[model samples]
Target: MYLWIITGVVLIVSFIFNKDKTIQGLKKAWKQLYGIGSLLVLVLICVAIALNFINEDLITQTLSGGNRYIGFLSAVVIGSIAMMPGFIAFPLAGILRQNNVPFMVVSAFTTTLMMVGILTFPFEKKYLGFKVALIRNFICFTICIVVALVTGLIYREIF
Candidate 1:
């Protein structure tokens, strides 16, 4: 993916140079990319802070004894409803794993966290078109379920 992205950048730069708009195009791309990077960093920081305040042991105890299927369902439901930052999710997942939460459940939850932002629905609809947003969310949710099932089967087979 990184190789493809770099190749795409090189191609775009060459095209811009050929068109004699290299400097302007580069500037525009840089600004847009930098803004996105900044936003991602900010989100990460917020997530980290939230995770730091939560009780890791308590979360682990809560999730560790649950059935794998139940955990997966809970993750999907919570991910859809909860609007917590990704940083918190990561640490929470780590704690859950330590206490024996199924890998499939964690994977599904993480996927849903980024893919199905219930809290952002209105904003997404306004900015990206309702149909587009709905379709994307549906696809993401379906894929998360499929992935969880496959991962659960694989884990069962391996261990």
Candidate 2:
């Protein structure tokens, strides 16, 4: 609601200032919107299917009985290896939570999924400098570990 109102205000302002430029910009945006929307829809469908295929029961059982350290380790290892989309990762985390997976582990896993993309390392190194990519990943990995530990401690204290 707020966004629409703001957009309307912008459009009105733009029209008052420069109708021709605004019209041209809108035309270009419309041309690109369809392709972008279709790509997003395709990705969403793929992620939904992947989430459905993951074994919720197994995820729950494994997490419910695991030690804190083990869970943290698993998060790091799994996060490093798992190459799923964010949409799929969140659903997997939800399943793990329902199964009694520790909050710290889930936090770590989620962090690693977003922060440490080992699967994209080659492309990252090629586009950005290898050293820059490695350093960034190392920092992110360290932060994930710290976040997991801090979150685990906080949860332990609270509950």
Give lDDT per model, in order.
0.71, 0.74
Worst 10 residues of 2 by lDDT: 53-62
Candidate 2 clashes between residue pairs 3 or more apart in a chain or in different chains = none
**Which regions of candidate 2 are displaced past 4 Å?**
1-65, 157-159
Q: Give the TM-score of candidate 1.
A: 0.58
Displacement of residue 10 (Cα, Å) in model 1 is 19
Residue by residue across 1-159, what tens digits does model 1's lDDT show? 999899788868788667566666768989877756755666566556644643455445545665776677777876664456678779888877777788887777777877887656655575578999999888888988888778878888224
Residue 128, model 1: Cα distance from true site in angstroms: 2.1
Give candidate 1's error at residue 95 in angstroms. 0.2
TM-score of decoy 2 = 0.60
